[model samples]
Target: MKKILLVALAFATVQFSSAQVETPQPSPASKMEQKVGLTDVTVNYSRPGVKGRTIFGDLVPYGKVWRTGANKNTTISFSDDVMIGGKELKAGEYALFTKPNAGSWDIYFYTDTNNWGAPRKWDDAKVALTTTAKVEKLPFNVETFMILITNIKTNGASLEFVWENVMVEVPFTVPTDKKAVANIEKVMAGPSANDYFDSATFYYDNGKDINKAKMWIEKAVELSDKPRFWYIHTQALIYKKAGDKKAAKKAAERSLALAKEAKYDAYIKKNEDLLKTL
Candidate 1:
């Protein structure tokens, strides 16, 4: 009986020690990052574990629209107009929400500033938008969710959400060129007439509308008593434009002198090179 007991004790001790062997646990989760601008907003939501199980209501409950993450509600702020899932939204910040389903998910936009849980208080006012989901043959889980805004242009853009077994895409189009320009005029409390003149000179070098460039630069020169080298160069261009080579040469000489006095090496070099062409 003692011998049998000793053997059993040894076996038990070995089993316990083997079970005690440490197994490595996975590292901590990554953070989410996003950027928003006048034209486009990008979101990068880190994938949370969906495990090996079928997601949706199972791990992340159904019927309820999740806040999408733990932090401040997935929010995108816009300074200009944007279209999401074919729905036009005026320029403003909005909370993003989604209703998970067995087949497809409904994306939502809440203009309400408050974001804690699913704020059902503002239910009727929420912008509900639906998008279709395509089936993936193989099951892949997303450990972190990521959404990105890309292909951004002045008037149109796309939002791309990528994750386990799914990619959600939404296309949007803004207003036309007139509207865009007007918006810029409203938003940009911009540079002065002097700045405009400098811009004109730079544009003239780059083969821009020389007439308009000359007009803006002349205005700039009129505004500033100390002749700016840029406007001086632009003045040269005006002379050159009018087919007066002597006057162009004289303007270039004046520009070179001002550039030297101002210790502007780059501007001096640019004007010196331009003078060679004249």
Candidate 2:
């Protein structure tokens, strides 16, 4: 009993010694996702506090490319292509870099995002889009660095950066109207041939209204520019189920010929069997 007590105490000591303590990061990481119309926008960065120090043109320095955030490269992603400074930026994730000036700031969307801060060797070709933003002096100082998406409209939004007593905004437009029009056209076009055929097949298989199935199968063939042998074969089955013997016979005969032309033996056999029943 004495030896067991000593061994248990030793094990407890080792467990306690190996336990980890959680702590907060100096510059905590943050992520934001927002939708501008149909476009998805995502941003990931680290927020570093001012801590009562000068930011731009001093610690951060001016006329040089800054990481735009602390730690890893600040990244922004777009689901669709966007227009910035009247130029197109392809849909993708890019590292945000900035060259600050007293009056204006040059913003860059870089193709490469795998870096601690800005890329060690700057490549002009990697810059997808470069835009200029006018710097505005704020009435009050901001304690933390932040990039805000503001002035949201149906077609566009603005990216506003704030730190210290300065603020800057870059406006961008998304292809919202183009996507919306495309979506509207697709919906207004009505049910496709496959849609009608599938609906008819489901109804026939599940023993639903045979009349509706017959109607849909006929529509399926009518909508198709060139009707398939399998579609005509299904139509024959639906018509027979609906007790339209004459129509079933006609559809089956058409399907048999199409199947022979298409060299589909299985459908040919099925159509022949259906016609014999009719």
Candidate 3:
């Protein structure tokens, strides 16, 4: 009985020890996210160490498609359309693959984002964007694979990859100013009812031109089927500023009725205050 009990206890202990053991990974996963202008850029990859081996032409053979990382295919995500290497790429996620050489590196953006490393048989039809970047030798050795977003500006940035003694940079541009200016021009050409109301309120508050304020506020009220309490209140204020107490009191009363129906306490109080002054 004692010998049987000892054998069972040893078996249980071995099972627990085996379950607790953890193996280390040779390459570890990493993620980077950045915002350039109004666009968001993200990268998911795995980092492999140098391990004292020649990287460029020996381990990661030259003139071959690399995973751009280790273990899994590297992925890059863009939130907005951008111009990369002077080629337009629509906003989306893509797998980053590369072909390295002594002089230049060819960077590929593939639509296939869920593959393990660079597949032996990758379809050329899956390639979305391809660009070439000049290879530059680094002054110091990088012990591990590194990816960086550098040279950040309001309209563009540079994506850099560094490993061992090799470095490559891919430049991209965002059309921030162009989009903003176009939107501004559009709004300026066609002013909405709210724009007229806001301009009237600005003019009335600043004591600029009472007649102009009245014209704009009237236009705002005319355009609205059911005028807002705030707009009616602004109309009352403009009348009061122009020294027309009767018209001001009438507009304030209308504003109070709308405020009560909407259950807006702040507008109700403002209308009451204006009426009291009249």
Whole-model lDDT, model 3: 0.92
Order of models, best TM-score first: 2, 3, 1
TM-score of 1: 0.47
Write down the lDDT of every candidate, Cα atoms only: 0.66, 0.93, 0.92
lDDT per residue for candidate 3 within 1-278, as digits (tens), equals 99999999999999988886568778888999998877889999999999999999989999999999899899999988899987998999999999999999999999999989997788999998999999999899999998889998989999999999999999999877877788889788687779889999999989899999999998899877787889999999999998889999999999999999999999999999989999
- lDDT-based ranking, best first? 2, 3, 1
Worst 10-residue lDDT window for candidate 3 reads 16-25
- Residues 210-256, model 1: lDDT tens digits: 77776777777777777878677778877687576787888889999
Clashing pairs in 2: none
Candidate 2 lDDT tens digits, 104-197: 9999999999989989999999999999999999999999889889999999999988999999999999999999999899889988899999
Output the number of the lDDT-best candidate: 2
Candidate 1's C-alpha lDDT? 0.66
Which is the winner by TM-score between candidate 1 and candidate 2? Answer: 2
RMSD of 2: 4.9
Which of the predicted structures, 1 or 3, would earn the higher lDDT when compared with the native? 3
For every model shown, what is its TM-score relative to the native structure?
A: 0.47, 0.74, 0.62
